[model samples]
Target: MRLRVHRRGLFGWEPGEDALAGAAVTTTECRNIDLDRMLDPARGNLVIGARLPHMSLVFDRDARGPGHHLIELDDLTTKSFARLDWPTDSTEPFTISQLGPRRL
Candidate 1:
């Protein structure tokens, strides 16, 4: 999956899923995203079996300081996904990193 941000909005495309779709993007002033709280599992447990896909995200030029937006899955034909709001300080710069533990 690849994500691109333009004048219109955020756009994502995944092979074998759908070509591309308009994404809901929100900008907020916050830091430290809790994965469990953002993505609630149907089993009432945070640790549930889910298929995580590879993603490539590109931020907008105006967005700065590790800015993050919550992306929701609304398309039935494509692999839906969501993102938690990330923190960004005015003094700092925007940076994106891959979350989760490393494989040993």
Candidate 2:
């Protein structure tokens, strides 16, 4: 399943937030954000951080085990949060703050 974000407000809707919400469809297949090379200053320009309330992960039932997982962002920080293990076979949507390692 593909996660998609929908805009509610008139304009300037948050894409990241939308993506997170869409992830709920299949939380099991969704995994943590890959931030291996996101730390690069050059890449930073493409990695725009946003204040998202939640994130969702979509999964395939027949192909996989469970379904998916969702994550809520309480706060924003430039620290790398470890990948969360799902209770069942599922996916989870996460933000950059939830993935990348903390910069010293």
Candidate 3:
């Protein structure tokens, strides 16, 4: 599935915490963000990272499958928002920090 961050005030995956949103089944082999989906008209106005909380993206295949995995986004560093040129290629890595008002 496509995993994306939820709005800051939205219900998180766990109690008292923020969560990410997912839709459409897709492999996690591509380590990149779906900017198009993030900027979808129906998803609402884009506020960048300030409106989103840093969260992990868990990838799994059933209860006992081999694809089980997790990506802890808070552990990585990203470029400043002003430095981003808006990567057009879907394959380009998009770190959560890049969505924020400043570099993480």
Tens-digit lDDT string for candidate 2 (1-104):
22121222222322363444433222233333333233233452123222232222222222323433322222123322222323233233432223333311
Q: Cα miss at 22, model 3 (Å)? A: 36
RMSD of 3: 15.2
Give per-model TM-scores. Answer: 0.23, 0.18, 0.23
For candidate 2, the 10 contiguous residues with the lowest summed lDDT are 2-11
Task: Write candidate 1's Cα lDDT for 1-104 as tens digits.
Answer: 42212211243443231322233434434333333343344431222213322322222222323444333222222434433333333333323222222210
Query: Residue 27 of candidate 1: its Cα lDDT?
Result: 45
What's the true lDDT of residue 47 in model 2? Answer: 37
lDDT of 3 by residue, 1-104 (tens): 22333321242323211222221122333332443454443552244333544433222222233432222222122311211123333454432322333432
Regions of model 1 farther than 4 Å from truth: 1-21, 27-78, 88-104
Q: Candidate 2: where is the Cα deviation over 4 Å?
A: 1-67, 70-75, 87-98, 101-104
Candidate 1, 73: how far from true, in Å? 8.5
Candidate 3 yields a Cα-based lDDT of 0.30
Error of 2 at 7 (Å): 15
CA error at residue 39 for candidate 1, angstroms: 11
